[model samples]
Target chain A: LNVNINRKRKWDIGKLIYMENVSAEDCIKRWRNEDVDDEEGGDSDSDDSNEEDFFKKKDENSSKESNPKQTIDLEQFVPYFDTFEKLAAKWSSVDLIKNRFIRSAVERK
Target chain B: MSNSKSPLRIFEGHQNFRLRIVLATLSGIPIKLEKIRSNDLNPGLKDYEVSFLRLIETVTNGSTIEISYTGTTLIYRPGIIYGGSYTHQCPNSKPVGYFIEPMLYLAPFSKKKFSLLFKGITASHKDAGIDVLKWGMLPVLEKFGVRECALHTLKRGSPPLGGGEVHLVVDSLIAQPITMHELETPIISSIRGVAYSTRVSPSLVNRMIDGAQKVLKDVGCTVNITADVWRGENSGKSPGWGITLLAEMKKNWCLFSECIGDAGDVPEDIGAKAAYHLLEEISRSTAIGRGQLPLAIVFMVIGKEDIGRLRINKNQIDENFIHLLRDIKKIFGTEVYLKPVNDPESDDFIATVKGVGFTNANKKIA
Candidate 1:
């Protein structure tokens, strides 16, 4: 199927990685499973689809990203409130660290 | 050197805290504590998007795990961007601005005993990285039984090798199913102790060649060596061959030792072109055009992608890549075969040609 992908395929390795391996994500969620919002609770009826969408390939030479709040875009695409709640926390900590450093550096010392 | 003979837990501080799981035993495995304490990083690099892991761990008989950053760099860095800046002065003198991303790690020892298995890493040693490995990981591993230190290269070009162009170098090893011992000795010896530099020089290449041989000899192993040089960087005049030479290097190494000949004071780009055209002949070979073989070198690539970095016109990547492969095959002729494949971790072009390795002004190993 003459795949006309503009994303350079020769050097892009996203496919070689195990996108479905739940260790890294599970590790984070296993810890952040506490902050669940019952109001927005949703069963992961489409985890397979979510996994597929989350792993959709992107452009190669891309250089920009969406805002921080929009960080949940990948998660937003996920129907599992459970997975989202935890991953959000795990990722938030990372953001917290980066944000703290950037803010502090931009401010005083 | 044996000590307490128990499991060890180690950690290092980078932009992020990377936890390493080590299994040291006939059965002893490292159990992740509910809490892992790590110091956070503040000093940072601009244009940085993703966080890199600085992992350290100790496994007693359970299984020894080694996070070798040095190997990661050696395999990948040599094929990355050509112009690597190295300031001669203080603080700025350390101007290397590239990092490697890791995928998975494994220690294949059946019965772990005093073993330091560095699964993923760059060959170049960062001051901070070494400090963590040596101080934090070493002592911890020693407690369990990490006697010999061994590491493997996971993803190439992610960390890059000594920076250069005139001598664009990459490697390909087509072998039948080899045992761990056979692979380990050669792999370990190939890059036991190495260094990096942006400028490509014959002296440096010779040194690496010599070092490789010595390491292999010391490890008591017999192996063959083939180097395909591609000199197509910033070279403007020889654009056609410059790019072609790179594709060629994926399956071949330069034959000339002095490929970076007198630039004749030509423009850097022109010199670059000349260098690429002449790379294969650097250490000139009388049999320039010889019989070809059918072989394909496939590499998976990955990298940080923002919103609109790439535009794959067609649906699948393999489709687009096949076209490039056809072009390469046509250039190299019918006898020779070439294909390009994408990996999941890196986002660089990997040219796969039968029975050959690929190289360019900058390095990329897919």
Candidate 2:
């Protein structure tokens, strides 16, 4: 029975091998899922995401506290889930588009 | 059968164990403590450690709280060495032990800020779920004396998944002790009686053989050396071993160390220098201490590109290592041994050098 197997598994000290022995995909998947956990779960203050948020929060908080008048979106610097590689590539291309508008008559492409 | 004064029944109730004072605060979960032997075979702590443990007395500070957490929070450090199972499992799984003093100030929100924002959750909710973790961190704090929390799994629910964390605090005292038992022991494979390890990289394997050759040569014992890497599909840089390795010799002991880095083609001289540093660090650790210093030193050097690019005019990498081994014999005493690794491809080598030293010296003159 599954119950019996669960008990056997529970008592087995060797189950810890699974901890040190996760698959690469499993490890990465687990790592990536941290973001999703932070989104759905509180108590997260998830380190994976809050780095930028800390700076933005500090800036906005200071602004609001000091000026007594600024509306800080706080989200200005915190972008959605794009990897560092993905964001870097996308930003370069978007900046290129802005640069290309210098003269529509001639296109480098 | 003697008189009433016979021996007075010599029952001085001194429980030799420095109060098993289980400091459990915050998480009201009740855990029964029949007895706790540190999972490792440490007979007892050294004087300094015991003296430091005396501080726990001041922290436990005559509190009547049945269980008082020595600190505000807990922390865990997931490094290349400690790996995963080295972690203490507190909850979610049928728990075994509890963490004692967790410095709590660098709260969850503070630990892995990057991972948190990725979830795009409100700070309040995020703070509630993973930020204020009460368990899984006490030992890390008591061990390393640092502020960083990586959460693996902390909640109580279905699909209960969690990660570990680390962070810094403005001012905190809960020291994170880096448990040494994790690395000092050799991992044995359940499948075989002989010690089995998977991540003994090719170069490291060669170095181990080299180091072993010297000691074996000196002792007049012929030994077999094997080599391989962890092919576990999930395996990358860190490979987990199944058993702890202790040499089966009578009077000799061994110390093994491996360094992995972007050491771009370090020369033989540099290798010897790195060897010196690694040896110094291993000798300094409270775990291996002086008792095990004399017999053997095994270094497992790991790197793909670094080992191949290394070159010395006098001899090949193996020969250079042998020279270093011979040098070790010249210095302290002529009994040190080695297992120098040679990685032809990518210039990586792992050497498990071993030696015999006179551990009876009384002073710290050196």
Candidate 3:
């Protein structure tokens, strides 16, 4: 009466897992939650209330299991979009100045 | 002053040897390579690699290269990229593209403009052909705001006997590259190709074009492929035929794929194979083609201090790309962050990185 317990692994766990189709805000929230989980796991040994700890752990596990998708908020990690906007503004201003100069030169000519 | 910093030590075989040397040169860092193919029976650098080293020495100034007796150990102290008019006769073992690829990286940062003449096999199975560099890589450079460049294939040379010649010219960048933030994969506007034959029957070029068009007709895009038959002196020492296809996308982005005819291969097979390769590249739906990712990434890392963004397919993140990322981080101390694009249908990742602001120290300040 031996039951086969080994499950076939579909993909390599060591390989990088890219979050699929997720927004920036949700990605930040997920990262925050992961940080909180890590902190809690590190201090779990100091907690004396076993029953309460079990229920808290169970809720956290259930919530994580419910949401399988993850996202990355690039703005939070780096100022990429902000930099692009700034550059665009600078470029427009430069173009405006150049255009005015060209118009003046043409009129003088 | 560079000698004050300790030389970077690298081990193992000659994988990414050209890239390592290029990075060292650009960064002005000395590098010592150990155990290059030490375990193998030959246990030394290949003839082509030594030829490439010689080419590097010919192009640069004040560079010191020391190779050990066994050619397994090498110490290279990089100097200023003093690019100017020069001629190099490449060994027949590898095509001219092998040398040209690294030159493309070094050229824009050089003190003087590059007008290089290379004599070797123009088209081969080992590396990108001269046509690919012309139609594929040169246009990609334009995206980085580098426009004054041209590659002219003077003669069509295949492998083995190898009597081909190409002239390459590139203007040095006056300032740092503009930030590249193209994240969207544009729609392909048209497909254009060249089916070239050297010392072969002129009809073979037409057969190759027909074979390519047969595969490309169903794509619903304007397909125009021309035949280029070289004869007499223009045809190289070896007799060969090949096809290079380019898929022109919107916003002037291009994807290139090429296949060369081997000794026993037919022209039709070569053309069809090149077409299929292009189709595969198109299907990847990346802003930069998979083969051009490393080059694009290197350019992005050395761009202006502002962040540059690019869209890359997840499938393109192979082992070599990872190695490139690690090497870039080690040398330039810049890292690229990848964020998944919010599209369920596509596996695209938007890679963003703050450039290191690496300007040419050799350039004179006005």
Candidate 4:
């Protein structure tokens, strides 16, 4: 298959970033469940006739993205939203701030 | 260092806030940015931008970041940069190059020799590619006496399905600021590129090369472009193909451009587009090429307190370049002056600035 996709494949990371009230885990879980449902559907409908339907669902899910919104119109394409959403969900705020430390004992120059 | 005087006050909503943050960290200056995209329909900071700020905070100690409830308005007080082994999961919204681009400026002056592993998109049509750093940035670092620097790609991830990995190891050193006033007239001695295709027909690489060479040949340039092909496991999680061209000049300066293969984009057109971009760069007599303005400025700011000069094409002088120059002046107290260079062949201009005499702020690692 000559898959010429214009859209780069990640999900909307901006929507899932760490916020004060919003839990990163919750965001990840919600997206991951959605992705799980997608995969199950893809597996069950393993026929050439269902390929069109598979792609149609992809376009609908990813059409409302903001980033890379208008750089070059790739036109109706499905990106790897599930992978990115899963990764973002897995990344913890603790992971981002793990090695953060302040050094004491600096001589005045 | 007078503590009595007030720090610089800057208004917000600028896209290049990372540049300001990096400079402030190096200069040890506190900056307060207000109204950060507050007026816009989608107000406040975006995910990748905030992630960049967090990365800066992780790399330094005693640094402070204060953000308002709405994600608009910020106060950043910088501390000494303590560079060491660190890994970051770059947000999928932007490519890894987005993070690595700033590291090119901060890594050499770090407290400890640093090794950074960045995971995410490696290449996108919208962001700088790993190849740009390999061919364009690494050589510029070497010119300033930065030793043992390595930028290597472990995997290739294209935008949207990014899972690419890259390892960059840089040695800590007090920069030897240079005086790059004399530019060896640029002559394209050779053309080299990587035509990368992932999960696609291996023959796509050849078609791209053939199409690109045809364009270069018609222009009467007879240099053969060497091509490297990455396939299967090496090519990241997604399927894509594109070409990145680096034209080596007789002088240390190099000009580079890239074009990724799009859906329905002809392999020949991808190759020809990259070749034409290179030809356009060749026509301009500037020492610094497009997409390298910010880098050229960083080199000048960090070099020994001598004057560094660069010539950029007139059309390339956009608002971002102008604002970056202004922010450099604000943060480092250095001035970047512009003058029109008289070139009949092209509308090129010159910019010159003296270094702030910046040195590593962290205690030497013993």
lDDT scores in order: 0.21, 0.23, 0.71, 0.64
lDDT of 3 by residue, B1-366 (tens): 144375575534576788888888887888788888787799889999899999989888888899999999998888888899999999998889988988888888888899999998998765778988888888878888789989999987888888999999997465666789998887776789899889988898898898788766656567889889999998889998899899887788888888878778777767776776676566554767866777788889988799999998765654455556666776776778877577655656788889988787666545
Off by over 4 Å in 1: A1-109, B1-16, B20-101, B105-123, B126-199, B215-220, B228-230, B234-366
lDDT of 1 by residue, A10-59 (tens): 21122322222222222122223322223333332234655445434331
Query: Candidate 4: misplaced stretches above 4 Å?
Result: A1-109, B1-6, B219-222, B341-347, B363-366
> Which candidate tops lDDT?
3
- Model 3 pairs whose backbones collide: none
TM per model? 0.19, 0.19, 0.77, 0.72
lDDT of 1: 0.21
lDDT of 4 by residue, B1-366 (tens): 111255665745545677878777777778878777677788888898888988888777778888889888888887777788889899988888888888888887777887999999888766678888877777777766675788889988877788789998987466444565743345555567878877788788899999777765533233455556667677777888888887776666777878788789899878877766665555443555656657667778866678887776654554345456656766776667655456444444566778776656553323
Candidate 1 vs candidate 4, lDDT winner: 4
Instruction: Please tell me which model should have the higher lDDT, number 2 or number 4.
Output: 4
lDDT of 4 by residue, A39-68 (tens): 222222134546535544554445334222
Candidates' RMSD to native = 26.8, 28.0, 14.1, 20.3
Deviation (Å) of B161 in candidate 1: 12
Docking quality tier of model 4: incorrect
Ten consecutive residues with minimal summed lDDT in candidate 2 chain A? A9-18
Candidate 3: deviation at residue B342, Å? 1.8
Error of 4 at B248 (Å): 0.8
